[model samples]
Target: MKYPLLLRFLQYIATLASGVGKRKKLFILIYHRVLDAPDYMRPQEVDIESFDWQMALLSKYFNVLTLEDGLQRLQNDSLPARAVCITFDDGYADNFTNALPILQRYKLNATFFIASGFLDGGRMWNDTIIEAVRNMQDSILDLSELGLGKFDVSDKSSKNQSVREVIQKIKHLPFDQRKNYVEYIASVSQNLPEDLMMTSEQVKKLDQSGMTIGGHTVNHPILSSIDLNMAESEVLENKKHLEQLINKNVKFFAYPNGKPEIDYRENHAQIVKQNGYLGAVSTQWGVASKVSDPWQLPRFIPWDKVPHKFMLRMCRLYCA
Candidate 1:
């Protein structure tokens, strides 16, 4: 869905009305890749050139702040107008080798959300499946042996999009079952890409370079798919891993998949706080406030195809 131009104008007007004359803050942009996306299941993981251009545009107007600073200023009401914060989810290796230098060159800082498990040969199952399908040539991939229904990977021109249909079939399973299905595909497939996910060393490099590390659950599981103990364990294990890696207080979180169905909820927030995290972030889009629950803040995912749409959204907030 498109953000109406008139609606944007109204947001600007509201900012003016709430605190006339000062710049107003607008967004928290969530990204996951800086190099090529293994597959484009979602558009946020655009290539480096597109990311460079997005940064160039954002650097022009906004005072991009680290996630903590943004929240603190948001509480103090000290943010400039057109303010926004940038975040990288899943802690892709490229965020260090590719995206970080860009932010550093622009002298910008952002929160780097790390899925504790994916570091050091831990590939997200979703990413593995996307790559696996992209490499496969056959129209149909049958994995009923692994207990999943058949996957038709061919073109969907005369009918629905083949990839979408395949993805729908994949998504139809229970979360745990679907991950196992991806694992089955990856184990059987060849021509796999580099473990595109980050390593502990890379995360340390970012932390030492002055970036903030946030907890994403270990194994990247859907919290709701499991019982309360398992969900708490997911949160605890992630925080423990990052703290051990960075040796600093890790206080933030990004919900895996960021959907209500994916295990992010009030219970998740309680786990975060009880584990001593200061705040948490969600994949849902919008601006946040001091009054906003830090454990349930909203985030805007930057789309790969449309930089102008990004520009308009950030004009109403901030970006890095």
Candidate 2:
């Protein structure tokens, strides 16, 4: 079926299934980077063409709102059918260079959650792993010295796998330990990209362009892997830096590696709230409604490439 027909059919199905007085559902779409072209090491990220079409579909079929507006209406029960809020996590420069123009073309708004520590030439640890593996001259990356296992980077496929394995191995480690591993990988790799993240000026430009900016911690640490006090500092400090940079109150938060209970806990949510954020989002896969906690709002991304299936999947999430 064509996209328009499928969307209409799905809308009718949703209306009939939801019946009367069903609480409004808010679908928060999460993104990391909108790449200029496909990167084998980060295949899941949407490229320029893919992101263009996705935003086109969103503008056409859904009532796309800013995060602040969406949550406020979700509370007041005033949301239109098929309401959604687009959000991007981490402060990638492509978000400004690649994602912003598409968003503007569609006249849509999105929230960007930034890891403040990575702004202005600082790369995230995972990106360190990805870039290191991507540019490695050796066919094999033997990390047995670091006890993270050896891997074959003989080709694109192996390099991709090695990147994933190495990141997973160190992702949840203590912050200092993870830093050491990432540094070791960086030292061994050649020609790593230094300009992966947005500069502070680009962040302010995003705000000037009328997009919302939210906090994603200072260092993008896994909150569960760090002490509570450190976690609190991460949350608060990020908000502080962003507000200072943008000259606007950063009203929302997205947990770094935003998994409930594992990456973050209830106390982390409390910290976000107490720090004066209006709300926060998690990496949970579902739709949010009135009964959902504002501090732990759920987020999802539909990975379907086909238009109809993608819209269908979105409808299913609403009814789920």
User: Ten consecutive residues with minimal summed lDDT in candidate 1?
Assistant: 155-164
Query: What would the TM-scores of all predictions be?
Result: 0.83, 0.94
Give one digit per residue, the lDDT tens place, for model 1 in 160-189.
344455555666456678877777777756
Q: Which candidate leads the pack in lDDT?
A: 2
lDDT of model 1 at position 84: 70
Q: Stretches of candidate 1 above 4 Å error?
A: 1-26, 36-44, 143-150, 155-175, 304-307, 316-320
lDDT tens digits, residue span 28-111, model 2:
999999988988889888889888888887887688999999999999999887889999999999999999999999999999
Clashing pairs in 1: 23-81, 24-81, 26-317, 83-318, 84-318, 224-263
Q: Model 2, which residues run further than 4 Å from truth?
A: 1-23
How badly does each model clash, as a count of residue pairs? Answer: 6, 0
